[model samples]
Target: MSMPGKRVQGGKQARGRAGLCQALLSLLLFTLLLLCVPVRAEPVLTMGYVEFPPFFFTDARGQAQGTIIEMARKVTQRAGYQLNPVYFPPRRMEKSLAEGRIDLWIGLDTFELMAHNTLSSKTVVSTIELRAYHKPGKPPISHLDQLAGSQVGVYFGYSYGGWMKRIQDPASGIEPVFVRIRSQAARMLTSDRIDYLLDYRGPFESQVDSNITGYLEYETLATYNLYFVLSRKRPDTYQLMSQLENAWRQLKREGEI
Candidate 1:
């Protein structure tokens, strides 16, 4: 009877040990799972873009919408980043990019832009033509010199084939009336506020029947390929750039870029 009683007590002790061991094993597995789980935080990329109608512009709903906007959305989203678009004058955009306030800039290449610590994507996104438009009944501006001393309506943050900087110089004798948006260029020209308005040729002619009209004509000055410039000094710039390159390559294969 004593031996049987001892065996029973041992059995209970063994069972308790087994139960404790099982509970410990479960706890270990739970801890392992917690360690293995990945933390996913989608990084937000602040992108700087100027107003270029038919390509980049604000819709009536006050949302930025255009071809460039669509492309940006796809590339950034696929790269695991959310895009935050910011509008600024071309000069200020460059400054903001250099200062690390803007993470990306979408524009044509130039020595000035290249001087910044940025990485240009391997793909050429698109081409834009710098064209000058004039109102009806006026002689067509066949040459740039024709309006040496006249006021030319221009957007604040766009590169007019480097002509913006040259003409903006005091010695150039050409007056530049910088407008906040692209829509105002056509209106200012028709209203005689500016002698000629500089705009992208393709966008200016894209209008089926725009709100502003007066037998407008334009002359193309120069065509430039636009590129996506990533900041070298900004945080997570390299990772974002790598993602951009990957997205751009895939897009090229699909003929989307």
Candidate 2:
């Protein structure tokens, strides 16, 4: 038979081993709990825009409000994202978007010369016909070539299709003048400084002050579609684009677009 002191010593040793095993099991359980838990998501996204009235503009509340804004909110909501829309002048907005400071922008037309690395959604909106705005008494321009010898004002950094490129060529004979902003161009048109202003129909109608409308006349030239542009610099760009496209389609099907 074992001595009593040896039996006592054996009992203490067993207890010590059992205590170590219990401690290790507790540590393993705690680690497993940590691994199984889900992490919280971050809320962050930047959207860029230029001040185009009726489509997008800052209201009295200092919030971006317009049809496009509504559409964007719906799409982003579906993706569990929020938009931090930044309003910049047209040229600066384009530059910021190219530099990766902004995640996405609306009202960007699909053009070959523009920053094409961006992923563009199928045309979500369509622009009314392009028009020439002039003082009440001026002759209308029926053909593109008729624009020659006329001082035409266009928004700076805005693409008016291949027409701008052609106009830029010295041999094209069209004298195109680029204004800093749409409001400035409207003012110039009203004052009869420029012979003509090339603009889309909706903005020309909605934004020009009612008092000035009597002095100006717009004639439709051509129509085009507008697209939502997504930055390629952002991760999961393809997935994001897909989500947005689906969301927009759903909205359209529901007659919300």
- Which prediction has the highest TM-score against the true structure? 2
* Off by more than 4 A, model 2: 1-43, 111-115, 181-184
- Shift of residue 250 alpha carbon in model 1, Å: 1.0
In terms of TM-score, how similar is model 1 to the real structure? 0.70
Q: List model 2 lDDT by residue over 1-257, tens digit each.
A: 66998999999999999999999999999999998999776465688876676777888988998777777887777667788888887767777776678888877455442456577787555464678888888888776778888888987766775577776777767778888666788888877788999987767668777777666887777777677787777787788878777877787788876
Clashing pairs in 1: 89-157, 90-157
On a 0 to 1 TM-score scale, where does candidate 2 land against the true structure?
0.74
lDDT of each: 0.77, 0.77
- Per-residue lDDT of 92 in model 2: 77
Q: Poorest 10 consecutive residues of model 2 by lDDT?
A: 108-117
